[model samples]
Target: MYQVLARKYRPRNFNELVGQNHVSRALTSALERGRLHHAYLFTGTRGVGKTTIARILAKCLNCETGVTSTPCEVCATCKAVNEGRFIDLIEIDAASRTKVEDTRELLDNVPYAPTQGRFKVYLIDEVHMLSTHSFNALLKTLEEPPEHVKFLFATTDPQKLPITVISRCLQFTLRPLVVDEITEHLSNILNKEEIKADQDAIWQIAESAQGSLRDALSLTDQAIAYGQGAIQHQDVKDMLGLIDRTIIYDLILAIHQNQKARVSELLMQFRQQALDVSLVLDQLISTLHELALLQYLPELSLKYSAEINNKIMQLSQLISAQDLQLYYQVACKGRADLQLAVTQEQGFEMCVLRLLAFRPLQPNEILVSQTQVANQPIQPAQQPIAQQVQSIPQVDEVQAISPEPETVSAAVDHLDDEYYDDDPFNEPSAVQAIEDEQSSDDFLEQELESTVEPVQVVQAMVEATPVQPESNADQIVFDPSSDDALFGMDEELAATSPEQEAEKYNSDDFLFDEIAPLAEPALSEQTKIPVQEVKQPEVTESVATPPQDSLFDLSSVPAVDAVETSTVSTMPQEMIDTALMPQDILKLQPQVLEGVWTVDKWEFWFRNSELSPAVQELAQQGVMTGQINAESIFNIPKRYEALLTQLQHALEQALKSEWPNTHFQVNYAEVETTTPYTMQNERKAKAFQRASDLLHNEAAVKDLMQNFDGEIQNIQLK
Candidate 1:
């Protein structure tokens, strides 16, 4: 007869229990001191000595040694209890007969006297599965059980048990065994059985058990049988389908070294083997955590094999602690979101590549002591900021990078010089002028924020530079005092007529250096008044006359409605062929506001937004819920929440800036609903349809398409 290792090595006494010393000690002292409870409850995870402890306690109560903690194995009562034949001790599986009728029938004979032992014991395993009515029926007898009887209840999930039923019993929580504890116990068992087994194989079984000794022993039994009474690491790995630790070590090493090729190769191997990717991520996360632990506490002993510890040590030394922490977090998030991915392999590969993407920059992370010393600011020997900025080129690289010479746009270049170096406090006129321009730094920041290339600053400057009309035999001069047209003409085509100026600025190379910038026209018109004259260059008969060209002349751009063969003379031939959004500057007007809640109103609000990204996103996804005197309420999605305190303060300031004395608040909306984004999308769709119809129906477009074999891929409107 083959006795399985699990049953063969089942602990028989209190001291023999593997991991639950606290429960054992408490029960042992209670029995030794003649103190006993009517009922006892044992609870923990599966195979963690819960039911086994219950049976052992039953034997101790019925043993011929007169109810002692250490049962006499030789006695008939103890032997019968051990072998499941004890008349006074009853072991029940509550999971099967969980009905109230069964519970009532079982409790009907509770008052009966013990037939053989000094005290009768009732052991019920998996008691949590009992029905609600069954618990109510058993609760009375459990609370007021006969003095001669002992009740022993065991369950893996104590939370499922009724509080009324659990409170009546002496609860003892059994802890899951650590890996090292299970490993040592299995080694002792294997030694007694005289079975040859590798230490690593035994550790593998222990690790796989996940803190359950019975499961570990059961796995060891299966391993021994599979290995023909001999356990080896290779055989165990083959049976469990666990990825080899060496592969994990190599993978992590490759990742830390940023070996993309090796990482891809290893992932291919995993895919070919049909390995579990989620499990691999879990292991990677665990290994990263261990490496992080070893970084700070290098001398600390870990409960793993020497090979695994060596791998951890190597990784700790190889990867920085910050990088390890980052890898661990990414791995954890990947594992949690693994099910959301379209494929497990995609999720796993992304997790691995993400680690590479966020690898710590060693050069930037660690600062030299000399650099730190150099960064210390000098207080007493501090020089004027202007002198420091101009004379000391080596003082700051940032200072040297700025102050670049003028390029195409004199307006932007002059503004940068005034912004970066000039003292705005000393020059009140310049201060007012800068304040009126709304700070050129702000516009530069907005453009630069969305740009990646450093040369874009110069490119944007070139695009904004104004062009002067080419010098001819005649020159036009305007009076500075009067608000009239060019040369003091007071018609609608006067200097004050923006429409006439716009048309001339586009058609003719008129000087706009004295005029206001269109982006912020109000202040530019009021404060930036300048009278100018153009000096015509004398023509030479020997020299050839050159055609005039102006960079970024926005006024000359033709309208979309005017995209016909007739307007081709004034507009460029290329623009007609590649024309896109061409909204007329003459017809363009600021959107009318309803000053109340509606879809159109929301569109207006979103169009005129000045909110931070976090709150702006909230506003875009939310609908206006309510409004008080000065405060506006918005319903935001619960899943997408803002830091309410920070958002409240920001929105308060923004609202006051836009509409004085106004305040705002946002809260998590209860119901899911459509938002302002939906309206914006609807608007975009209609506009797109209009553009597509106009392009496909146009006569010039159809002729071009027929002649050039060209097709419109997309259409956009400004």
Candidate 2:
């Protein structure tokens, strides 16, 4: 005996229908103008007034007081139609009668007059379910029905209906209701029913309906029963298994503040309550959207409670706008990754950790501005290790540090300097040098006992012998110059002979038949080449020492069979070491070439130069434009400008090593002339073409083509 709320509150007339004003107005207008279509079709989703409108139209046609859109409920015909008992109103569920025979049978009564009303109404509900043959059988009758008969069709899916059947009918489509429309309708229904309900609870039910009035009323009926009398917000939330709004808001705030522990605690509560974690991420994303709206557009309303609005405003200010966008994207991505995670709880925890991990920088970790960096003083870059090792102190600086005490070696050197105009290496002078060394030694011993401290003697030794002898025996050079016979000879020893000198120092060491460095030798007739006093360049103490990458630069060293080492007592170890080195290494890095440089020479040099692959490619791509003021000018395409700039310094160094005087200058420009790369490619292509033509003209190839019908499949140059 209990009628459900959906059925009890169903709209009966055109005026009573909710959220279908278009259909109602059209039908009302047709009735007022007396221009009603005989075949009527209503189409929409479930619970959107499709069947309801069709039934209302049926009542308007059957009403007693001349047919009208608003039929009087007091009439027996209207009452019978409302109660589903009108004889003339034949309602057919097309889903049940889909056979052509059933359609033909249904069309059997179309010619007859109305038994109880002015028109015979055939209402087919879910008409799309009818078979093709059934639709074909009904199409003719539906198009031209008798004067007193009307065909009414209603289907949720109008696309399934035959276009022929649809063409004969006047179709009206119904639209689903929005949340606000459903909510307002429900409130009015509840008010008329005199059932108390919370607005939030009603809103929850309306939102749950998803724009269907039937579902909204059905939920309202269930809620009324569940609440025993009055619907409450908490009861609705519990019924729907929704998390508390305040809890959701608090969880979001905890994540924003980087409160990991608090977030974990709240997540544990969610786990204990068995709430949907995915739904929580959805809510978080939604809340972030609202927060962004509040941040960028502060004037926009959130349509929430005052407390919720205040919380949103505070959070918008607390988190940076950039961070808000990052958090939103991270939340959305986490939601998608949830299904792939091993467990839902682990996935949710990881997502929360990400939100806390990618927060804005703290005060101490802020980046320094360019202005601050510019204000700080710049420090020089550290020299390479090899360069640092080569930086030896000058001889003057060594003398300044500790004043040189003239000892045996300094006395011998002074003797050479004083006797430069005469025979410096004569036997007498050598003997005199030995006698002076002996006298200096005796004086040093007497002073060592009285005034010369051991520390001062050690300092004198260090200062006197500035250059240490190399440990390698092969590094010693034979210089037939100074008193080689004076040093390390006792008083009882005799002077050396020229034959002994020649035997002691190898004859091959005297390569040039000219005067050599240091004091010239005045020995036997065998030593005819007088040693020339070559004045070496004076190196100032202020000049910085250049770096030497290696101890032995074989590029500058000449090929030599051997050099015999002989004791040169008077020669300073530094001068001996310099003389021992090859002529090229002894000289500083040469700056100027001996002759003019040519492009062909440069090309040959480039072909042989050892360069990296990228650097080599750069050289091949560049075209030598001209030589300007001893500089080789090259132009590379502007497209390769960046590459050229990067490899310019290295390529220039390679070029300079071959042509020292010619500077390599490269510019980025449109290279119109042929480069090495283009020339090489052209040469290769021409060679390939010539080879191919020679192969094609061969007799063996012609025989194979004429006899065996063979064709050349491919040609490749190896």
Candidate 3:
């Protein structure tokens, strides 16, 4: 029967153990010095020579000729121990003998002297599986064992061992073999077995082992068998489910070039070959990481394989370092997400798609040419002035007018002498400064000019400009103070003016009264309005100033104003009261409110309670106050004020149609939490009483119970 390569080429001695020099040296020195501890713990990951070292230590301690670091295998003690027949040397698998009784029975014999060898050795493998009780029973004996008995413990999970047990034993940790070490070891094994293997094949096997010598040997064994005694790169690659490195490089290049079709073709090829999608992604991520490293640190770039090195160099040149980092992050995240994907192929495809989506487009030369062309102003066949105004919104018309200030000022100056020369406009001396301001203003106007229809801007501009009444334009407008005719006509006016004034007053009053009743009642006297009084000189006389019908052209006053007025009247009462009627109601039209509160803000406020809910709630809760000074009226906490401000703005937009020019500031007033003196005293007394009761019922009782667990049950406290 031909034995498998893993078993045939197993390390038989300390010198043969791979990748654990520190552990080997310590065990060897301990044997040579005759300073061996009774218990030794070998801890490491699988395939790192944990069990191999344990057996070697057993052989060293039990060698018949002498306890030598290099045990003579021909000796009776060495051969028996190696062949597992030595009476004094016992090897126990803790994984199997994990019961407390097993440990107790085994340790019961520990006190006896060795039957044949200098020291009796117990090799326990996978010792972490021992039960708590078993560890407890072994702990005492392990701490202080007889001189002739030796204990060697091996475990992959040292963390599971009781700290007490760990403390009692001497520990040696075996490190994983590096790729070079594993490759060299595989090479020597292949030579010993007379198997021909490529250096790259050996290296691939070594890397696939991930720093485990046993695993590396096992993989090499499989490769040799697969190749019928001679290992090659293709055989190893097939066995490990690895995609060809060249194909991987080509795939990465395709991704870098953003060749979506080529990338998809490669993925299909991989699928046809039944390649592990996750592993392929893993390798890709690893390759990208290596490339990123090369881009940053040229010195560390020497270790990769020739193909990988070449690919890294090419990638480093093709992609910017920042883009490379981004691709690396995307690949890494894709690798993680792949695990959760329904299928590895789907995950891999998604990762590829993500890379494609995020990859920056190469600068198109054609785009630059087109941009240059677009930059050259193409004059329209018709004049754009009328089209520009029509394109801009009425509100933005103000900003549009700002840019032409100098030109308008110049126009105004020309008009000043010809029309009204009392005020001469100053010209801005710096044309560049004017142009800079004009550019910014034009940018804003362009947005409006493109979005707004020309008719609206014209209509708005006409509406916004104040025009003198045509009748008053020719009349000598008397100063109100100089016009005594107005005062003498008061009695005559009362007879004629009562009905018109009453009707006008009733209309205005009815509009305000309609919304006021829906508002939250005014808060208590403590919450006062912070109103500042402005005293204006009284109009001493009434002048026949102007007629509405004669002012400019009454025909062009716009039906929009009536529509706006009706809209404002129809708004929700709460919104009208809170946002439209407070102050500046004349200026805040529905369109202005719409612009101020974008669609997002409107939706946000509509979902929340109507404006002034807090104040209303406070009034209902009986916490209202009427003191209106700034500190007293607006001292509410920032949290409440923010909530109120948001609500107020939303209300403004909602009710702008009803009250076009309303302005209100949300004021938060802080209220002091006052505790009554009687309540405070009562609380203090209760706290003291509770403390006294706790001392007597809990602390004192605990002390008494602690002192008397039945030893002094009859004793009574004074």
Query: Candidate 1's residue-wise lDDT over 1-718, tens digit each?
Result: 9888888878899878887889999999999898999999999999899888888988888788787888889999878877889898888889898999999888888889999988888888999999999998887788888899899999988999988987899999988899899999999999999999998899899999999888898899899989999999999998998888779889988887768899889989999999888888887877887788888888888766788778778778877665677778888888887888899889888888887776554422222334443344422214433333333223212221332222313334344332234432223232121233232233333222222122333334334555564432122333322223221232222333555444444553343432323222212122343332222223222111111231112221222322343455366634532343322211212455434454445545654677767777656776764432255676666766636545657656765676674556666766366666775565465545544654565443553475458898835455
Off by over 4 Å in 3: 301-308, 363-718
Reference-based lDDT, each prediction: 0.66, 0.66, 0.61
What ranges in model 1 sit over 4 Å off?
Answer: 303-308, 360-718
Tell how far residue 176 is off in model 1, in angstroms: 0.2
Candidate 1: clashing pairs of residues: 484-495, 485-494, 485-495
Candidates in order, TM-scores: namely 0.54, 0.50, 0.54
Give the range where candidate 3 is weakest over 10 consecutive residues by summed lDDT: 471-480
Ranking by lDDT: 1, 2, 3
Report the number of clashing residue pairs per model: 3, 4, 29
